[model samples]
Target: MYYVNQNQINKRLEFLNWLVETIPESLENKPESDKAILFLAQERILHLALESVTDIGSYIIDGFLMRDASSYEDIIEILHGEKVFPSHLLETLLGLVKMRKKLVQEYFHLDRNEIYPLLHELPTTLSEFSNSISNYLKHELNT
Candidate 1:
């Protein structure tokens, strides 16, 4: 039997919830002079949010004895295989996984223009991710 750590999952979900709530406000209404600082800050937040997502997914996979994930992309793939989220979300989640890699490995070379558009989608994507995990957990636990 797989042992799901409800508390651990919920804690991560709470953090994800915080990240989703923080993204929109962080992206908007910034002073022109502060653009550089804002970009860096947003970059860090997005990185953290993406990290939290993978962390939560990994936790659930381990708890449920799902197939081992060989990479960050695999983590999303495994969750998708289990129907944790809809098919439409699979590509977006995979893109975020790739973005996480870019944030970590290519930080210095990142283009603000390229990243800025994605930031606009962060809140909605993160919210969808969090909700999917929460719903999956609720169903698994109750079953």
Candidate 2:
């Protein structure tokens, strides 16, 4: 059971929103030389976890890669393991897609259909989810 504090939730949301604006910029400005290093680090971590872990590997992979998932159902099953991922991780993933949906579409010149699967109206969804999770945490943690 996770005990998510209100203060933590607020802080995490703030951090997530800030990162929402920064990540695309980071990827855009990432230097040619550092791109390889960045990918190497990512691959290194993926291989390490795949080699060593049982229950949590897919969670890490899905969160980081965001694709290459075998199936949506498999991802959901992994996410429902004894250790639920921190709620903000889910929120951030959804929130990032939500926040950048338009920008990505414009930048890539993609049509609505192309970006549809990549984004959701998570600003609305996240608010509801945040409240619900907060309520659950309050009840479960008695905090």
Candidate 3:
């Protein structure tokens, strides 16, 4: 039996949704670069979104899966092992983890173009994550 932290998961999902709502229709329309404040806001939002992703994984692995995963990829893999996450998301989540590392450690002089598409689709990815968790739990509860 798994003991899930639905509240925390939902809260993280909510925040991600909020961030998504704040994003403009297209990043392509912006100037080659953003103004100082715009850059700051985008960076902050990315940081929080990435942080929430890790936190959600931690909550599940620690609270329900009861496993200690040493790294971000490991966390995802462990959850996958438990049939909690689909295999298709493995590549994207791993990429997100790498991007998070880059954002945290090498954010200075980073290229926005590379990150633009990821930012654009972040909401959908996050929503998929939330839905995956909800569906997994529902299936477990039913079984």
Candidate 4:
């Protein structure tokens, strides 16, 4: 039998939702116009969102699935290995892991252009993540 820490997962979901709301829908004209503040804000928010993603993955795998994941990318792999995340999301999640690394390891000379696509997809990506987790939990609980 499998179970989840629903409360913990909900908190992560709430934080992810907040990040999605904070990020801009489009950065076409905004990044340049605002320059310093907006760019830094966008970068930080995107970094936080990626953090939230990994945290959520870790929460699920460790707390609920009772599995140990070695690294940020391994979190997603562990979830996938347990059939929590669908096949389609694997690629994007890996990309997110790399982005998280960029934000953390590559501290200096950050580029907004590279992070833009992830920000743009934050809303939908998070929605999919939330739904997938919810659906999995629901199935596990019911069975």
C-alpha lDDT score of every prediction, in listed order: 0.83, 0.38, 0.72, 0.76
Q: Tell me the tens digit of each residue's lDDT in model 2 across 16-37.
A: 3443343333334367888755
Candidate no. 4 TM-score: 0.84
Rank ordering of all candidates by TM-score, starting from the highest: 1, 4, 3, 2
lDDT of 3 at 68: 94
Q: Note the clash tally of each candidate.
A: 0, 0, 0, 0
Residue-level lDDT tens digits of model 4 in 82-136 = 8886888788777777787678778587777887777776677777887888888
- Model 2 TM-score, 2 decimals: 0.31
What are the runs in model 1 whose C-alpha is more than 4 Å off?
none
CA shift of 42, model 3, Å: 3.1
- The candidate that achieves the highest lDDT relative to the unseen native structure: 1
Task: Give the higher-TM-score candidate: 2 or 4.
Answer: 4
Candidate No. with top TM-score: 1
- Candidates 1 and 2 compared by lDDT, better number: 1
Residue 118 local lDDT, model 1: 73
lDDT of 1 by residue, 5-48 (tens): 87888898899898788788777877899888888888888788
TM-scores, one per candidate: 0.92, 0.31, 0.79, 0.84
